[model samples]
Target: MTSVNDQTQIEQETGNTEGESKDSVKQEKEMKPEESNANSPTELSKLTKIVKHSKPEQPLGFDGFKKQYYRYASKFGTTLNLLVVGGSSLGKTTFVNSLIQGSLTGKKTAKTSDFMQHRLRMTDGDINFNLTILDTPGFGEKCDNSNCWKPLANILVQRLNAYFENEIKACRQLPIVDTRIHGCLFFINPTGHMLDPLELYVMKRIDRFVNIIPVIAKADMLTPEECARFKRNIIKDLQHEHIQFFHEPGKSIEGINYGMPEPFALIGATKGMQSDSKNAIRGREYPWGVINIDDPQHSDFCAFRNFLLYTHAEALIEKTHKVIYDALRTERLNKLKSQPNGFYTSSKKLVEEYMKAELGRVERSLRQTVQDKLQEKENLLAYTEKQLEAKHKEYEESLINRCNELKSQKQSLENLVRSDKTKKHSIFFK
Candidate 1:
């Protein structure tokens, strides 16, 4: 009976151990799938979903990237997109080339025959821009020629549309391009001082498209009195048409001013290597007042390049915004005005309220944007301060370490000298 009981107990223990082994194997299989899935790239997709639905992580750490971005943005905050347009031989090509090459000498490479459209690109590190210089056919002498003015105007309109279409689309969701016509440099010869009726017609047509900047080219050919008279006359004519001018004094370094009815006085091109014209005048200047390639300062073209890049970019952005706003406002007003009397009166009221609310929202958004920019500036300043403090601390620590090392060396030297003296005295006394 005892022998039978022992065999039964052994069988029961064997069964129990086998069951435990099976359980352990099942547990390992269950955990293996989860462990493999956890290390899979597909797991990132799940994390992305969670992040999308959750609050964004705050910006962390100030570094070179942040500093560089802010520095570039601040420097180019008012970058303008400017389109230079005018009759041929009016120094449009020369002025543009000079501006880009920083001197009239470099404009030698530009083709100046008839009307040709040329595009130039300028870049500073990561910031890149293009200047489209449309050399429109000269209009005054050929204005009445239907073949000339009509085709020119049509082409101008089409090109203008295409240019703006591309610009608007590219900047549809960006903050970089904000202003159009940051300024215009319209080249008109001062020697003539007479407005070509054809030029005037073209101006009227393009005026609806862009802001006018009446630039008096070849001012060096005109006497000071003549320059003054030309400026006044141009200003008077522009004012008569209700056009405004933003002027910069001949040698002023002030921020550019906008929205004046009078034409600004700018000597777009000058003659000779005179100090006044070479150093003070901001635009491209030619040697001996020639708008041709013989000028030497032509190689220093970066200044003009910078000007075009800044102005063109700003103007493109501004103009785009204006176009959008105008279109929306006009469409809304037309729809409201088209309604029949008493028809959908409640709808009209609701629409008006909605428009007003949208306008208010835009204004509030602008205010909030300004506040955010200010906060960003403050953050940048604080970051710079912290960096400076860290550098200062590091320098102080280095200096302290250097002083301690010198102290240790000096003590070693002093001990060596004292020992040598003691040895000499002991020998002498002995």
Candidate 2:
């Protein structure tokens, strides 16, 4: 009996030993994987498995982007960013107000102080583009015993520089001056045949920046022959100054006159009228004729708009891009100039060093700027997506509610129909 009992105890002990061994093996198996993972190089562990199974996200096509751009651009199209700059009292504001057929008493004139900007839209047509006319305070205005050209030029340069930098930087902080400045409509008085010294100075400054379109504003003050002669003289002067102008193809140099054609319209405070009646006079003796822009049939403003649309569209777009680039370069030069004392003792040496260092710096800066902008865009897109999702959710909820209401109405109608059928059957039976 004792032998049998000891044998049983040994068997029980063996079974217990086997069970403990199995548990140890299972624990080790689990620990081995964890140990291996922990021992593995971090980078090696991070190597993503190339599962060639997922579909790629589709990208928007060029046409899609263009369609999107066009949608936004359509809203901005009529808003022509026109900077009317010339010598004082040349009727910059007058011409602007006249174009939009608005009074210069409060809103228009008040908006224009020292370099005022006003957005004007045509009340006549839905097809008309919005015009944002920037009436720069008349250059050469007398202020505190000084001609304002120097200060104005300085201000203009600064503004130009800022505009250029913002464009290049694509800086969202600055107001976008629609890099598409269609035309610089330079207002000149026909009476003042010769360019004033200040005018000459302004013209030279303008030549550096934009494609100047000289418009003799008070055209009614001159005869057709006199207007032609004046245009020729002005063109000659501009050419002498080495200014290149965009002239219509096949249009001869003699025929290449600035400003829109025919019965030049003018807006007065009281009434507007066009004078097509030929002035029976010579150069200075021509009557100053005025025309209301309200008369769309005879309005020179319409001609101006038409000219911009058909003839100068390409020139304007091209000029805008050039202006943006020029502005950026000028700003960069100004920044370099404004650097602290002895920053560039020898320009040549500094330039060499800058050349060596700047390419890398610019590359890095560009990368960073692009990344920031892209991230911002991405954030905006994400926000927009969330908004859309919320809208969709709300719409879905509303649809569900409407469907429930419809279902309830349907049930009620069915109940009514059944009740009516039962009553008719009962009546028939009776």
Candidate 3:
């Protein structure tokens, strides 16, 4: 242990170990920065690529536009309802045909007709909607026109009641199809005077419920001077009677001087006749001259059409829901809430009756379902019994055949024994 050579070897070994440790330290120092980078997010940041996004400069194609349009249509259900009210021979069908460009599918209604509804798919660019036109053919045409507006009002109220019932249902359908009258186009006769008593009564009664747009039908029958005077008198009469028409209030009345206000003068013609200039025009070719229906100077048909179909279309729909429909709904709810004891009792009795009927229906359905299941089970049981009876008969026949075979074997054995005995006796005698 005290040898100089041993001491020298130990010192050499120690020196070698120290030198190897120093080399490892130097290598670890060189990898320190790389290890730090691996632990940090710097490497990930370097690998990521950055992109600059911007709005598309080019417009979408027709297909993409249609997709977007349908998306919008889905967001907002599009169904337009229009109520047309007029007397007999007012050319309501002709006006509808002309407006829709010969796309009406319903048969032409007669002078005395009931409430008829027609549907058409209207398209504007990529957006599409359903247009429902309701025609009241015999309105105000009766000799006793006193109760003419009652049917129309009752129909309107019925639709509102149906919508209200659906709204208050326990489970309501998504996106209720609105069948309420959004607008009423009331056609007035071109008598070149003022509004008749019947017309005033109907307008005043229904104006609060719907957007009324009074149009003077067959304006071609009246001269220009007569038309202007009639329009003025009609406006004065409407204002005097406090009748509400579809005029955008809160807006300036400056357009009144520029164009006829409130009541519109219209001439409806389905057939086209050539003008003096040989141009095809939609108007009446009278003995004196041709009156172009689309001309602003000749008639207000173009302005009224634009107002109804394009400009104020959304307004009419919005007002119907926001003003008329909502008011009716609120009133109904209030009535239900404010009912007295007797009325409440009656209503409760009615509700009980309805619930009893509904419960009876449900019970009948459930009983039918149970009866059907029982019948199925009975049929299966009958089939099983038949199979069991057939198998039992087959087993009994098989047992009977086996028993007969065994009896024949026994008889054969007896016959053999008798023969053997007889042979033995003969042998003994011999």
List per-prediction Cα lDDT, in the order shown.
0.50, 0.54, 0.72
Per-model TM-score on C-alpha atoms: 0.42, 0.46, 0.58
User: What would the per-residue lDDT of candidate 1 be over residues 358-386, giving only the tens digit for each residue?
Assistant: 45765697799999999999999999999
Candidate 1 residue runs with Cα over 4 Å from true position: 1-82, 102-115, 143-156, 159-184, 191-194, 243-316, 323-430
| Predicted structure 3, TM vs. truth | 0.58
Angstrom error at residue 276, model 3? 4.0
- By lDDT, the candidates rank as 3, 2, 1
By lDDT, the best candidate is 3
Give the number of colliding residue pairs in candidate 2.
Answer: 6
Worst 10 residues of 3 by lDDT: 47-56
**Candidates arranged by TM-score, highest first:** 3, 2, 1
User: Model 2 compared with the native: what TM-score?
Assistant: 0.46
lDDT of 1: 0.50
Superposed Cα deviation of residue 289, candidate 1 (Å): 9.1
Cα deviation of 244 in candidate 3 (Å)?
A: 2.2
Return the lDDT, model 3, position 244: 80
Query: How far out, in Å, is residue 171 in model 3?
Result: 1.4
